[model samples]
Target chain A: MNDAPVTAPPRAAALALGDDALVLSHRLGEWAGHAPVLEEEVALANIALDLLGQARILLSLVGDEDELAYLREERAFRNLQLVEQPNGDFAQTIARQLYFSTYQLFLYRQLAAGDSAFTGLAAKAVKEVAYHQDHAAHWTLRLGDGTAESHERMARACGALWRYTGEMFEPVEGLEVDWRALEDSWRESVAGVLERATLTLPDGPRSGAWRAGAGRQGLHTEPFGPMLAEMQHLHRSHPGASW
Target chain B: MSSSTDWPLWEVFVRSRRGLSHTHAGSLHAPDAEMALRNARDLYTRRNEGVSIWVVPSSAITASSPDEKDPFFASAADKPYRHPTFYEIPEGVKHL
Candidate 1:
């Protein structure tokens, strides 16, 4: 590791954000051959590629991208629990996408408006995340209102994913975005999408002991370890080999 | 959960750039118009191939049958005088 004179705070922020993108990109990529339809396969892959691009940029700011992605232990990752969760059914995946993409769009928008280390990347990434948010919102609306079975699955997924969302708005030391405003905007937009979809806002607790995440402190949930092993397998198997 | 077979087929059209007409791309299945547009974006524009997309239900389109090709197009084919290519333009003329 190159121990530079840069302060600890920005490095930590970059790792947190970068890991979120990397983990979620991997999760999305897992759907490459398995999405419910051909169109969905293309859609999910594009979204995965976009997130991977963002992750590479963000991780490069902190350290070697390959090492950060493939060599780190599970405990070393700082991704949100929401991103690391397995792709359950399609509805669950959409619920996760809706929640995280909404938060990411607001966060990037806030960062882009200010002069920070993140400003340039945030400005560029905000547009892509806007599309991602729109995609998730569209699917949520479709699945929520299409049929009784779809509505039940969608509603259940929304409730299951709700517990992991509070961690997104928690303050990071170096990032300058206002956490409270971000949380409020995220809630308002998500609620609006859910209402328009004919789905109710999840009644699950967001910030109390019942909450489901501690990822900001490098703590993750149960699913991350196996996922990390799979993601790192090729890179780890062939040390320094490049195709 | 609707089966994949239940989704309706939509024909995709793409405008590759500004000032261009949307051309037929391909087809994909979607539950509704909104999803159809999004599916077209992902399927047709993944390589920066399009600037805009239009999705129409395949059932909504009316097309000429290939079996009627000679009967349907023979009338127009014989009207060779309608072709601007046959017009003689003076060498001094610029665009004509």
Candidate 2:
């Protein structure tokens, strides 16, 4: 093994974002065979795969994909709680997607403008995030207006998720400017969409402020451990093996 | 506006970039025109495949039935002059 000490922290930061994508994608994939509407089931699955693909590219960029994806312990994972929180119901899933994808749209747009070393990757990602945002926005409008029951559930989902959304913009220590501006822009955009969808943005302890940190510092929620165990079981059980 | 009618079916067309013709993409369901356009963008243009999109309710499309294919198209086949082969170019024709 090469013993060179890695200096710059941005590489690791990239992995933090990548880890969020991987974990959230795993949750999103759970809806593949199980969305309320058949069409939506397909749509969610496709979007999940898109996120997973992004995760793969991102994780691989930071370190070995296998190590980043499968070898890490739970606490070692850096995914935000927003991505790790359990997906509740259809409303909850839509809420999560709306929250995450909207943020992703802003992040990608800024990254495309920024001179990230991964310019090509950021360029490709912008397209996917734009569509993901559209998907989430459509769901937000539908569930918010569909029926009294749906509206109530969606509202609850937004309130529950709104708090967790804070961590998405929590800047990496010493890398604050990199993420802070994007976070502010994302909020403005999300607010507009929420207004149009008739959804209320929550104001509470969990609203766009850090309930926890060190997802950037490589600390993760409780869910990360079990998630990694499952994701890595097959690969770790038989290392150096061909598919 | 029958409540019994199913959600509107939208016909999708995507123009991948400027100066390109909008080509048929596929179809989806949405509650309104705006949502229809958004759905088409999400489903068909997720990969930056299109810079522009169009969505028309499938009900609005009036397609000729397959049962009338022969009767509808038979006249065209007999119009040999429509092919432009009947027109002879002069010896000096530059682009004939």
Candidate 3:
């Protein structure tokens, strides 16, 4: 689109980050009307709105936000596999939020500290992501230490999502971040939260034949297709539509 | 979805800005005071509606009974001196 903001190199990084926000926003929005409590429903929706705002800004840097969001094929999306994973259960959703938001907070903090194109957005977004990380961490602590059932569910969710996390540390073109330090900080922060929550960090391989990491390279997992279909359905049904 | 009935109800108080007394915002169910504070932030202050928040367990409050409305409060209605309505002589004062 003519209104696309950045050029090719930064475009990759923007799309990668934007897609993560957009996809995760959609997944979190799925909690509407179904969260365990009214308070939780509001909390999740508020967080989703914040992510949606960030997604809009990030995606706009690449191209027309609507076209990029609604017209992209499933394989074209560059979101992390962890974000595209289904919202299995409440504890599972919290686990996903904990992992992703912690990474996002660290990534944005690093980006904000640099002189990159992402600095402005990252500066503002870091505050929002801090709240998101806190929300996820608090929930993790409560659920992991609450009842036996909750603890088991939280543990299972954490284990199931562990393999997808390594993809987050991979370097993106045009972003000036120390990937190793980012990964180390992310691991330390997440491990601390998990420990305080009384949950163990899953010791599975994060990147290997059995694990996932290709989403940034325009590859996605099985659930991403259906998610994109549902997300894009409305815009595709009515071309050039606006409300 | 887990049952929220097991969680205790908390009364939320929010101070809209500095120097203002915290007023009752609303209530929500949460497992503990910490979660209740967060829930209060989401429920009542998401739109910059507060500068501070306080969450108290609903069970801790001893509320006056509606059935004793006259005995508990109506006796003060006949006393006119208790009302601050006689101090409107100044022009610039507000929120008095």
- What is every candidate's C-alpha DockQ against the true complex, given to 2 decimals? 0.66, 0.20, 0.73
Q: Which ten residues in a row have the lowest lDDT in candidate 1 chain B?
A: B1-10
Tens digits of per-residue lDDT, candidate 1, B65-86, equal 9999988998797787899887
Better of 2 and 3 by lDDT: 3
Model 2 lDDT tens row, A33-150: 6665545666777788888898998887778887777777776777777787777888888888888888887777766675545455667988888888888887788788777888
Please provide, for model 1 over A1-243, each residue's C-alpha lDDT reduced to its tens digit, 9 standing for 90 to 100: 134443343888899889999999999999998999878888999999999999999999988999999999999998899999999999999999999999999999999898777888899999899999999999999899878899999999999998998889889878998999999999999999999999998877987789888898989888998999999999999978797
Comparison by DockQ, 1 against 2, better one? 1
What's model 3's TM-score? 0.93
How are the candidates ranked when ordered by DockQ, highest leading?
A: 3, 1, 2
lDDT of each: 0.91, 0.75, 0.91
Model 1 per-residue lDDT at A23: 94
Predicted candidate 2 versus true structure: per-residue lDDT over B3-85, tens digit per residue:
31367888999998899999999988777888778667558986879988989988899999999999999879878888778
lDDT of 1 at A31: 96
Interface RMSD of predicted model 2: 5.7
State candidate 1's DockQ: 0.66
